[model samples]
Target: MLCATFSQIEIRGKKGRTVPVLLTSEIESNIDLLLQHREMAGIHPENLYLLPRSNFNSKEPIRSTDVLRKYGKEANLCKAENITSTKLRKHIATISQVLNLSRHDLETMAEFMGHDIDIHRSIYRLPQETIQVVKMGRLLSAFDNGTIVQYRGLDEITNYLRFKGGLLTLVL
Candidate 1:
């Protein structure tokens, strides 16, 4: 388990899954500077976890307040002088933008920053129309392959198809 102020990260096997993280107010204080800058770019702190690199230096481990303070100075944010967690969040937010972190990267950052999984998904994982198409394609493929063993009901099938944006017509 890799522990940071924002979150506790546990990396599993090659095809492993990430565990849920609990974000506390204490971790929020550490990234205050970054959050401030993110808000300026129309990105909310609640959505900060969506970015790949929320912190100024993604390569370094920001597990301590002293490290945060030192980084702030190097970034010319003077975080220690400011003393507001909000300020620190904003500063980090600004750096994140400068670094051009991607959405996938943001998810990793969210994990690193100790944001809850739900919060991370809500902000970054917007629903898309294409998802339906993909599902429909898979269903059709399964049908062709004779892999669809037992479908529950018309409504259940339709609902499943609807995910792929498909409309069902009961021929029976």
Candidate 2:
């Protein structure tokens, strides 16, 4: 993360892109609490980082691993050791399937994750069950909304969704 204002996060991204993403209300509230805590603790308000390194002399943001480990321990959450930056990114990529995002949306997500879409699709390969659920969920959603009439037959739909743990070109 690069910087922050009251409303948004400015990412000095890994891919050399600087993007300002607005925070959700819930996350914004958490940030407010953090700001308040920082203020009470005499953290200078002028510091640029949203999650600053504890060392006052350092300009670097707090490490992702440090944040994960600290929160995991404080929350008494099991397997916090398993929570990592890569795992968090993969979780975002995987859980986003339930949203049935369009190609453009997926591209945006990949970019946000500091990669190209091809890498996202290939490297973030989800489990077979997750893939199956997403594909079937799409089919069911289409059918429920009467878009299934666009297809000539069930075979076509089945073939369209036959994602053998690889790219399945979406059709409607």
Candidate 3:
């Protein structure tokens, strides 16, 4: 017998625009954990797995308004007068910086936080010495085949590569 690893379906908005929402393996594992917790709580094995309510107000079908009230309180923070999604996004960005995330990690976090990766990179990516090194590498690698001369040392090789004008054609 064979088993499948996992699968995903692409989600689209009402306008038919594809959303960049991709679930990691962690999500499926967390759902399995939730199911295990539900079974431990004495929910019937047959009914052990069930979707949360659209409003997610209860662990079970209870009429208590406490969960709803809590949700309302949290929602009030994003209310027009108090805070905006933009503000919340800025807070998350700051937290990402404080945590010292790398560029790839920041991209993942931005996706998790429902922000544009380009915007996150623009705001959070610091200019580092590695960027200059990469630029220099590109500059050195742009020479013609004839321009690549054998040299005694790495510095001489680098200088020969960086040499411009008729020096490159003369080597041919």
Candidate 4:
């Protein structure tokens, strides 16, 4: 399907969920190359699957885990064995959370990711200690500056974090 400028391909994922995958130009070119190679090799024009097995008649899905791990080793990514679909999904979930979308927008994102908000956060959105430290520092700084929100009872905390104690130690 078409979206904005890039192409979006919808496919059935686990549990019959509809998953939309966007193809960048580089990935599109790679797919084109594969199709060209398949055509040159005299593969059946009516092949039912995109990444058909070497047998050509098997209905099995391509093993992207093996491909990703091999590519990771060649590209010097983290441990090759760690390259996996779940890792990629978790990365997308966790990274998208950093954009600070609204609750409604997050729900839309969760829908697009084929999961509900609770499952998305609990299963994929892993907590990073460094990120937590940075966010806490920023929150404390905002409170200290009285820029985030003005709450009556939070004044004590704000006053305490206004560089008086070691409560707010942000170098950013």
The model with the greatest TM-score is: 4
Query: For candidate 4, lDDT tens digit of each residue in 1-172?
Result: 3464588889888889998888887789898888879766556666756786656555564688878878889998767767788877778888776555678988888888788789987886646765555456656777678774543235323433344363443333
The deviation in Å at residue 9 for candidate 4 is 1.3
Record all residue pairs in model 2 with backbone atoms less than 3 Å apart, i.e. clashing. Answer: none
For candidate 1, give the lDDT of residue 77. 75
TM match of model 3 to true structure: 0.29
Compared with the true structure, what per-residue lDDT tens digits does model 1 show for residues 100-130?
3566776576555445446655544423444
Local distance difference test scores for all models: 0.50, 0.72, 0.52, 0.69
Evaluate model 2: give its TM-score: 0.57
lDDT of 4 at 118: 91
Residue 15 miss distance in model 2 (angstroms): 3.4
Using all chains and alpha carbons, the TM-scores for the candidates as numbered come to 0.25, 0.57, 0.29, 0.64
Query: lDDT by residue for model 3 over 101-160, one digit each (tens)?
Result: 567888777866656788777775546554444435443564444344443234423433
Error of 2 at 53 (Å): 3.3
**Cα lDDT for residue 34, candidate 3:** 71
Best-to-worst TM-score order:
4, 2, 3, 1
Off by over 4 Å in 2: 1-7, 25-47, 54-56, 127-130, 133-172
Instruction: Report the Cα RMSD per candidate.
Output: 18.0, 8.5, 13.3, 7.4
